[model samples]
Target: MVSKPSSAASARTVSVLALVAAVLVGAFLAPVVYDAAAPTPDRVAVISVDGTITSYTADQLEEDLHEARENESIKAVVLQVDSPGGSAAASEQMYLAVNRTAQEMPVVSSVEGTGASGAYYTMLPSESIYVTPSSVIGSVGVRGSAPIGGSSNEIRTGPDKASMTLDHREAQIETLKHAFVGSVMEHRGDELSLSREEVAYAKVYTGARATQNGYADDIGTLQTAIDRAASEAGLENYEVVEKEPSTRSGIILLSSQNGNSTVVVEESPIGYDGVRAPQFLMVYGQVQYEDEVIGNVSA
Candidate 1:
C-alpha cells in the first residue's frame, strides 16, 4: 500500500475527476437552457370575432384556434363574439374549428354586443357560452334568395342545371334549416328547453332570456367567462392573452374529380369582380346607406 503511484493510475484519476466536473456543469446549466427554450405554460388564448363573420373572420378564428392547439403554453380558448352573424358557410367553418379545438381544450364563448344567427351558431361549439345582461343572442335561421333560373336562350344543358327549380330550392331551404336544427339539438340538447320547431323559428333573445331558456350558460362578462373557463379546466393559476391572428388574404380551392366534376374556389375578401352566388346566411342586419332602413330585411 506504500508503493509509489504509477503514471497510468494518476492519469485515470484525473480523467475521472474531469468527467465528474462536466456532469456537474451540465446539471447546473440544464434548467437555464430548458427555461429559455420553452414558453411558460400558464396562458389562455382569447380570439375576437367582431362585426360580420365572413370568410376573413373565419380564417382568423381558425388561425387562433390552431395556435392554441399546437402551442403547449395555451391552456384554454375564449371566443369574444360581437357579431350579428354573416354567411352561414363561414359560421359553419368557425363552428367546426372551434368544436375540434374544444375537444382538445376547454373553449368558452363570451358575447359582447350581439351574437345572433350565424354568430350564435359559431358559439354553439364552445363548452359553454357567456353573455352580459345586455347581450343579444339567438336568431338561428338562414337568409338568402332561391337559386336563379334562366330560360332556354342560354347554352343548351340540363333543365335545372343553370339554377335549381322551385321544388329544389324548397328542399335546399329545408336542408339548411334541418342542419341548423340538428346542430342546436346536438350542442345544447340536454340543457335546451326550447323545442326543435321553436329554435328553427329564428327568435332572438336577451341574455337573461337566453340563459333562462338554456341557450346561454350564464350572464357574465368576458372576464367572467375567462375565470370560469380556467376554473373548469383546473387551471388554478393562468394568464389571459389576446393573440393577434394573421390577416393575410388567400384563396382556398376545393376540387372534386368525380364523373360530374366540380371545382369550388373561395376568396377570403370581397373580390374586385362582383361575382358571387347566393349564400345561405344567418345574417341579421338592416340594409341602409346612412340612417334609413332600406327594404327592412330584418326577417
Candidate 2:
C-alpha cells in the first residue's frame, strides 16, 4: 500500500538522522581528547638577574642551572644580567654556578640594562658575553664595609664584643677585597691584566669600553645573545623559556633573606670628628640592637 512505502521512507530517514547525530558528537569530542593527550614541548631555561646580586639570586640560578643540565632536551641557557653590584661572596657563588653549568651546556650572558662590579664578574665564566650598545657593563672591582661606633667604648664580656676593634674591621674589609680580586684574576688574568690599583679603585666602564678592554666579549642585544647561544649549541630552532616573571614589584622586599641589621650612619651624632658609629651589632651571627645613638643615619 502507499502507506507502507511512506513508512519505509520515514524509517530510513530516522536511521540517517541518528548516524549524523553520532558523527557530530564524535567530531566535537575528538579534538578535546587529542589535546588532553598531547605532550608539552621542551623549552630552554632563561635566568634573569635584575638589581643587586645576592646569595638568594645565586641559589635560584644554581637550581635552574642544575635542572637545565639534567634535562638533555634543553639546548642552551640565557643569562640576562641587569645589576649594579652586590656582596663579594654572592658574586663569587654566582660565578661558580655559571661556570659549573657551562661545562654541560652553553651559557650566554646577556647584559641588558646594567652589569657592573660584582655583576660584571659573574659573566667571566660564561661561554660568550653579549651586551647591548647602550648597556653599562664594566665595574670590575670590589668593596666592603663595616660599621664603627664612635660614641660607646663599653667593655663587653662576650667574644662578639671583643671582635669589634678598628683593626679587625679593616682587616675584614681588606680580606673580602682580596678574595674578589683573586676570583677576577683566576678567570680573566690574561685578558684584563688588572693591577692592585685598578681592582681597588672600582672603575665603571660602558659596554663599548668593556668590550675594548677585554671585560666583555661582544656588544649585542638580547635576541643576538640568544641566537649566539643557539648557534653554539647547534640548535636549529628552539623555544625560549623566559623564567623570570614580567612584574617584579614584590621582589624588592624579599631579595635578601638576612634581615637589614647592619645600619651605616654617615654623620657623627656624638659630635665626634672623623668617627663612624654602628647603630646595631651582629652578635654571634644574630642581629643585636645597640642602644647608643651616634652618627647621622645616612643608610
Q: Which number leads on lDDT?
A: 1
- Candidate 2 global TM-score: 0.65
What lDDT score belongs to each candidate, Candidate 1 first?
0.77, 0.65
What is the lDDT, from 0 to 100, of the residue 100 in candidate 1? 94
lDDT (10s digit) by residue, model 2, range 1-299: 45455888999999999999999999999999999997655455678876655455667777777878888778788888887766566677777888888888888889978887677777777777887667786655544334346526667777565646667666766676676667667666667745656755666667887777666788898888888888888878578888762332112111121433333322334543343322221011122223322223222
Model 1 regions lying over 4 Å from their true place? 1-39, 245-272, 287-299
Stretches of candidate 2 above 4 Å error? 1-42, 150-161, 193-200, 246-299
Pick by TM-score: which candidate is best?
1
